[model samples]
Target chain A: MNDTNYTPSVAYLGPEASFTHIAAAELFGHKGLTPRPTIPDCIEAVTEGHVAYAVVPLENALEGSVPLTIDYLFHGGELFITAEISTPIGQHLMVNKAQKDFTDQLESIQSHPHALAQCHKFLQYRYRKIPLIQTTSTAAAAKYISEQPALHIAAIGNQLAAETYGLHIVEENIHDFHFNHTRFVVLSLRKEILDHKNHAASKKTTLMVKLPEDDKAGMLHQILSVFSWRRLNLSKIESRPLKTGLGHYFFIIDVNESEDHPMMKGAMEELAALGCTARSFGSYYVYETDPSSE
Target chain B: MNDTNYTPSVAYLGPEASFTHIAAAELFGHKGLTPRPTIPDCIEAVTEGHVAYAVVPLENALEGSVPLTIDYLFHGGELFITAEISTPIGQHLMVNKAQKDFTDQLESIQSHPHALAQCHKFLQYRYRKIPLIQTTSTAAAAKYISEQPALHIAAIGNQLAAETYGLHIVEENIHDFHFNHTRFVVLSLRKEILDHKNHAASKKTTLMVKLPEDDKAGMLHQILSVFSWRRLNLSKIESRPLKTGLGHYFFIIDVNESEDHPMMKGAMEELAALGCTARSFGSYYVYETDPSSE
Candidate 1:
């Protein structure tokens, strides 16, 4: 929801140097905002009115869907997607200032496994058969390596993490894909951020729908048919099994338009008749691509 | 293709304690399998002609997509999906045998961040706000905590990891859902096994297509239109952006018909004319529901 009077301070799922922090930073970059730790904490902050808003990662270009983000949106109706931000995630081969040029051209390649996987080609082409140590975070890897200078290790991390941990950017953008971007959703109590920004007018809206436990396949068909019947476009749909094991499934949907339309209203109504939990992430916006570069 | 005469050795992503290992074990439960140490190794094993099939994760019940599996499928057409297996995943709270009981319950709760998030509810319900330590693997956490017994530290992992490391199950099924499954696909060099199991007449086939470096939306439409054009049932469609960067996307499609049909042949021809790479994974008998469980 748009709060014209206040600059929204959003909470993100984090531990100081998480990608969620990066997402929050990008979401609030134009507005100059700060982020709190943890997605649930972010949801709680929004619910308790500690901050004007919160931002969390709904999906990643490489990893696909994020379930906790979907689950929180499905369960917590207090916050809605005010805007969306997509940032190109070009990870790096960062090292502590102490580690110099490689003698073997390869030491230990330390990083979060996901980061390691994203830079799979680089590691394979360069190291081939060297040890790949998994760290909790890129920051954690950098942090640990900063203390163990003699260990001869290079950590794959973000630019910010390298700078923060006094590490040098030994190699830039080691990820397999140069155009990696993680998409984030800005959440707020107000459901109408679209009108204020004029920025989100052309943006997409994300909806989370919880499917009924009984006859799962049939229920999925009925819900999908609603979108089909209306000729409404769905950009993405991710099915996440509800963790409570109640046999219910949650579908995180990204549509090309807002929830204000008659067709969308009808779709939601039909969705409700199916006897399931359906909630909107309100008005969301995604980034325009830099065609020549990206 | 299936090789009915020869039992092939297989490579999968895992250490003995990994969920990947559990999936590999279950998928090859009836038949013996040799598990590889890593997914890259698995891919390499198949590429080097050491193994006929490699089992890799396509998607998780909680997470939407697994990109590397798709990347390998796209990069190497020499492999095809032979068997699809779904393995149940449930997080467990384990403690060293020496530390029989948690003193303060949780001076700390250790796990991979994913496991921590998956059992967020159980953690919040069980303990007060305590430090949650993230490790590379749940098994790593179990091994660490088991080797260094602490009163209030409990590790979250699988039963196998806990038992192997001489840890007791402090809490069972700590995952968010009961039906949590990671889908695994077996890639083979030839379609021999399926052909052996198939009758003289059979109906479905799996195909992998690498769309041109152009309009992604248009490609998805054309891919979908082919099945809709033939009135063929399109069951599953998954897309992975190719590693080569912008506009290049790889799609995996499952159709309820054989390639022998002229309509299907024409559709394949049309798809090929669009300047895309397509390869068939052959046709095989499949049960939507697990036959043994059913």
Candidate 2:
């Protein structure tokens, strides 16, 4: 029997112990979080009314953007971003407790491709000969290592994953860069929730703008001038393929203004007048999760 | 014993039959193409003088930019883009030849994440219940299916991979989109080759520009104006994190002009005056591989 009376359920990209899991726990606590296998499944759960919200990683400091997440939001389905959570990523080299001398006998390492790549320097310098296995997620890697109980095999994951899978940390802060962080966004099908949650002072509005198909000089510059002339800060800009053909792209820009801001609306109007179509994906406040809490 | 005098060696991302392998063969045939395990290895092989050139995917029409390749060229090592090759990606559903009628008992499908994602619609529609296994490369997936023949196992990869690994094509053109293509670039250490090979009329110059640390309104607009005022055509523009902190990024722009072009040099000089730094990654010719030849 399904119990929906207690708390609202949230779906996150997971097998439990993923970075998205930590992000979901950070925002909504650990009680009503459901671990979904893929990004689409997590998002679809919200759209299909199976969950109240879905938390998925949007971007990483090291890896520019999660392509699947960006693609899905830009073109796949109709879901609005309600809020964002930033988590400090700390990748650890973890192994089974029985494998005490992991460095001496470590035959192979496993992790998601991004995690493996973040810690590439350490692996190359210390264990060049060891093979690296790729998994769907870092949590999956930790789960696999815990279940297999193989000697000389380890995984690169976060502290939450290590604890969830009953693995010991072989090395801490294994990622190459110290400022590693990932930003996860909360998505929901209901527009009322997004509209009601825009009271926070610190907000950002995201827009997907497709320029005219014709090759016009200074067209992209003109689009940026709409925001710059208003003196509104532009935080991020990324180009995604329009998928119509080669060399065709639509730009996704994040402006430091809420949807309710008059300037933001005016800019969108001006962009439209210049033969560009803009789709606003709602505005949301960003909350940074404290590393000390973890 | 190695034969160095016979042919110049080239490294590609490989375990024998990767798309990069196809790109390498497209450029240099199959004889001197050495298969390296990872992108870094392939790039490093050229930088370390072990090979003459390294072929790696830069971007896919559907997948946007290849983060690892972009990051490495932007921040990792000293290498120049000498040439660019465009390859048409054709994903095929392959199975072991001996295992006929695999669809009836299809238990699992395997491929590189990108390949799998590109064919998500087909997989979800036809084999909804089958488990999808992630492999290092699509070529590796085909090879695995060939070596360890299973009744219900299939792989998604290119036609060359099916031929290389001796697998039978169960279905051709399995990808969801028909115009799927990947752009591969040749990375080399010598600047002379890049300069001498720029005679082709169709060339593109790439520049990495870092904005000022202090946030200023209209600064990005000013930078774009430099390119726009000169009537220069930008083929592509992407922002990559500088890894210093969140919201800090450096832009990589591809201009339709050679590095030696007078207007391009003027644009770079003006960008410098605006408290920004620009690094040129050289101009290279683009060659499209004819699908009919394959």
Candidate 3:
């Protein structure tokens, strides 16, 4: 399984045509892609040596962080984020081909809760009276709607889902915000590996830092001070519950520098000297989805 | 209603016996407590003058922040936090009275997905084969189980929910963790007010701060630098999607100081000078739940 010469397969959270499937295809091409039912399953597939890597949603622009992915990285096995992929999310109103002409008379709308919530404005303005059912995923909704062509049900999902399920796109880009995007991370047992065709556009080193138990005043500021003076640029800063109790949190800082950089190393060393436990989640290369290829 | 002198009824997010209901009852008396179907409904009840205030959960120790409450505060109508309530979360396994003696032979378990996820370990160990149903809330599950007397369905909810629905608790504190807590905020048109019997145990000022559009390097550090120099202790710092695009976020910072304090005021001014837009969400006094009273 550790054949560095030959990269095997990759697993993603999916039932085919889900966002993770799209991301996995974009990263590893259409070959040897396995769709796991859940995020945990995808991650376990990698750790259990079923696949060379796993791709899962890390965060969304409108919905914020994916807790399962973050929690897995924080508390689960020894997996590292080997690569980062950012893709623009385009949600469409898809219906079965049998009822394509009767788009206005939808019996019900279905999608993942987040997707339904994303298209909330459109749905409220148009299909306000129609019931919105929550499914396990966008693809699941699309599959259900496709399976029951007699039922006039619409699904809010990506274009791939409509194509995969033989559905027609009734409306395009129904999402409330045009700026919706989801960030996916490639998790691998080994670090600093990109088995895909795309080259690295940039680099980011994510560090999970926990301050000393006695949260003294300005402790977080001091932690920031370590990187502030060194001129390390931070792309994102997020705090997650330590799960111990209220008022306890650990910061996930994404620094715009490679882990091997002197400044990054010095900052981690300084954090330790200040009695903070800092772990480098990963130093991964950032890649953007090729719109032309899609 | 402009009747600041005369306190009116309050609205809370509830299907009866929910955590918000418990928090509302803890803050206000049992009288004049209206239960709204949703968080937005509760907030709207206050804004539309149906109620004087709305009590909604802001954050949970395990699940993190409640986006609906935060979004309403940031983007919705004019509202201010008048009071804050912190309550311990105790999840219990409850069954209908008819099946009280057959707890071990339960057919299914139902709860809000968050509640179900919280009690994942207990459910897996005891009744792994039981089908888990997702309800809108834990109280909803309790209500449903109570209504269906013939079904051997159990609900994992609070003690109040079990008592309210006349259900028997088969297991107490079934949640995997013991340090779970939820912070609920009392939203009102007027600020610095507490309409309850309990006095303020502590004070906190929450600020919603956004960095300039250019997002210069170390801009966040500069923002923190203002409070760092003043030695303002921050209880929590969370970043939410600005809903514009990726790599953009506005932070919700909870500082352990009154908004009127000079240090706090100076920090806002400094932030303003640093090309940051900062708004004081509220300067509310925090009240701890009286466990003995419950």
Candidate 4:
């Protein structure tokens, strides 16, 4: 019954160069891998058992939550976060070195929509309207642009993407915000590890719960009451609408203890009785602050 | 010497059919009006005095925050939420009536990238690879597909958009979430408003605050502590990167009171003294909960 007996394939949103894909690979760290083509495909793969695990992005500091990820979590079936990973955004102005006039010589700025968005001011100052087109992924934009002309077009992307497409970074760390970090969640057919060497890491469990139909008043208070009564330290609680029904919603809470912890187990039992769907996504101490090289 | 002596023209983020445009019309209902191309242009109009006010979408109930809107508030000169309005998601599957079996014979889905994302599952179940494409606006998509000979392509848009584009509503209320609401804030050339009527109709005051450079934990707790001290009810608090230097962040707080309300004004004064950037938008209370009728 141990994980050592399992060799389940892992699926993630990818083109082999997506930030999500990169985060997934890093989260898995050389485990069984099967990169899927789209976010939904990865969700479907995990739901169908085509793969034992899947990885997707939840939110970035710049952009709050990945609406799709929230939708996937709310819409029922597919997956749950087995573990969470925080990825840093150290984007740069990537371009093919063949073109000159690097400083203020941008005709068009290109990258994944999200990247283009995160560096909103830089583009506003430099190339507001030369046509900020889209690519399938940041890597795709860099690869496609580097192949032909990098004259006036520059792609703002991460260093990994710049390296993958063999492009030079014209300018480094162009993100308007230096504290940018994206929280990515790992989902698998199996459960994540909770026991850790450190005491601080011992009491952490992630859960997603669906609120009852109708009644929006005192929403958070009602959800918190369950945790407070159980003496569970409800460290974080966020709400995402249940994508299907009206007035129904999903509440994700980060508790300060393992499910195996005696008191926390009692809270989970009461929470389960509330008709709330809860999942244990490993218990480990997460970096309390955004870590950046800047 | 008074706002009563001057009535300012405002440009919003859309045409007649866009939600921002509708919000502009609603906020500036009888106020002076000017139309603009993009959100930034509207902000520019306000900043440069081309218009007196510019309305921008700050956040959604389902999606945490509009990243571009937040970024604009961070970079654009001297702007803050002058007023707030909440509009429910009026989602519809709009199609050219020429297409007879629209659902059974559908080939593609078109809408703004966000709208497309919001209705991801409905399309996934109904039409898997039916080529979900993005447009500048949902109205733009509706307009674009109106002239196309391909009868199978349809757009998911708002009711006003469908009516304006002369498209038929093949399906009503198609958004994945039921309680979908987008909250917009009006930005102005100047900080203060003209009259008490504006304040009387206002039920919320939205403010932007930057965490002081001090590295004390619970800076947010400190910010909220002020409101708690005054027994002020907070509607929501969205945390976003400050878009300035490293490790710095900004918080957008929506409080349940008009700007003129003593509780809110006192809190604003305290917040400013704590190195907060506060701007009070004119107050109007319009809480439309019905997603379809809106």
Cα miss at A245, model 2 (Å)? Answer: 1.3
* Candidate 1: Cα lDDT at A191: 79
Model 2: per-residue Cα lDDT over A10-41, one tens digit each: 99887688888887787777888998766666
Ranking by TM-score: 2, 3, 1, 4
lDDT of 4 by residue, A1-294 (tens): 125666557786665666665565554544677766545667778887888777776765322236566666545544555566667777788778776456366677676555665666677786666677655456767887788663667887777677777887888887666556676676765566522122234446777776555434444444566666566665454555454633445666677677788877776677677666666555654432223322
Candidate no. 4 TM-score: 0.74
Best by TM-score: 2
Model 3 segments more than 4 A misplaced = A1-18, A29-55, A60-72, A128-140, A147-153, A290-294, B1-18, B28-57, B60-72, B101-112, B128-155, B188-192, B289-294
Clashing pairs in 3: none
What is the CAPRI rating of model 4's predicted complex? incorrect
In candidate 4, what are the lDDT values of residues B1-294, reduced to their tens digit? Answer: 135565568777665577776666655553676656445566677887777778766656322236566666665547655656667777789888787455677777887656766776788788786888756567778898789756788998887788777887888888776656676777875666433223335466666676667634444555666777677765555555565543466666666677788877788889888776766544545443234446
Off by over 4 Å in 2: A1-6, A61-65, A148-150, A192-201, B1-6, B61-65, B192-200, B292-294
Q: Write the per-residue lDDT of candidate 3 for residues A27-48, one digit (tens) a residue.
A: 6777789886555667778987
Q: What is the lDDT of residue B88 in candidate 4?
A: 76
Each model's lDDT comes to 0.65, 0.78, 0.78, 0.64
DockQ (Cα-based) for each candidate:
0.22, 0.43, 0.36, 0.18
lDDT of 1 by residue, B1-294 (tens): 144466657777665566665655554542546655445557778877888778777765332136555655666667766666556776878777777755455678787666777786787777647888877667778888888865668888886688778888876887654566666767777764333332324456788877665643334555566666567765555544555653345666767677677778888888888888778876654312242331
Over the stretch A119-221, how does candidate 1's per-residue lDDT look in tens digits?
8778888877778887766667878877887777888887767766888777787777565566677777887663333243476777888766564324445
Superpose all Cα atoms of candidate 1 onto the true structure and report the RMSD in Å to 1 decimal. Answer: 5.3
Candidate closer to the true structure by lDDT (higher is better), 3 or 4:
3
